[model samples]
Target: MASPDLIEQRQYAEAVLGGLNIRPFRVDLTDGLLFVPKSRIAVVRKLCKHFDWPFKVTALTSSS
Candidate 1:
């Protein structure tokens, strides 16, 4: 189950991204991560920069 804080964060993130026409594929509140399509990374990064949000890219592995 998602925690209340996580749900709030997810909604806020969705709203922010939606305004920019960027839809996140997944929101991992527990890990404090947001996953978007590979093609959207550049734009996401730009938005993150504009908002001064920490942006990181992690490669997913078969084991992960």
Candidate 2:
């Protein structure tokens, strides 16, 4: 399981990414909400659970 903060963050992300059909990647915890479609979000989540760290599984995009 991820840390409390990490879990919270992940939950928030899942909620935010709902039905978007996006792909997320791990890029370091401090990196912020920047995801790339190259890895499975579930894999990342499982990894996070295994490593006990927050995972980044959302597509990174720029705001106009």
Candidate 3:
């Protein structure tokens, strides 16, 4: 189960992404990390920058 704060964060993130017509990436709220699709990283980064959302992009070793 996710914590209340995490749930809230996820909802907010979803709303933000949805508003931009961009799919949301899985988030590790506890670690303050977001996993976005490689193909959409540029758009996601642009939106995050425009919205002043702090984030970092890192390559994943595996999709699963």
Candidate 4:
């Protein structure tokens, strides 16, 4: 279920995240990063796993 194309990846991500109520504060398409709420990290991780998407988590100095 790996997303081979960027457009499809974005669409899939949007749909999955929306359904899970994990709204991203920012989306950096150039780097393909979604800055979602810190509290929802676990959900995001689960979504990535379920979709066979490779993801990494990075803590940022921001409020959730």
Best by lDDT: 3
Give the alpha-carbon lDDT of every model. 0.63, 0.51, 0.64, 0.63
- Candidate 2, residues 10-60, lDDT tens digits: the string is 665555444455444334445544365544556545654665544545644
Ranking by TM-score: 4, 3, 1, 2
Which scores greater on lDDT, model 3 or model 4? 3
TM-score of each: 0.56, 0.35, 0.58, 0.64
User: What TM-score does structure 1 among the candidates reach?
Assistant: 0.56
Which of 3 and 4 is the better model by TM-score?
4
Q: Which ten residues in a row have the lowest lDDT in candidate 2?
A: 19-28
> How many residue pairs clash in all the candidates, one count each?
0, 0, 0, 0
lDDT tens readout by residue for model 4, 1-64: 3335765766778787787677654545566566677788777767767887544543333652
Query: On residues 16-55, what C-alpha lDDT tens digit does candidate 3 reach at each position?
Result: 8777766546666666566776777787777667755545
* Residue 11, model 2, lDDT: 66
- Error of model 4, residue 53, in angstroms: 2.4
Q: In model 4, what is the error at residue 60, expressed in angstroms?
A: 7.3
Clashing pairs in 4: none
Error of 3 at 47 (Å): 1.0
Best by TM-score: 4
Identify the superior model by lDDT, candidate 2 or candidate 4. Answer: 4
Q: CA RMSD for every model?
A: 4.1, 10.4, 3.6, 4.6
Task: Name the runs in model 4 displaced over 4 angstroms.
Answer: 1-4, 54-64
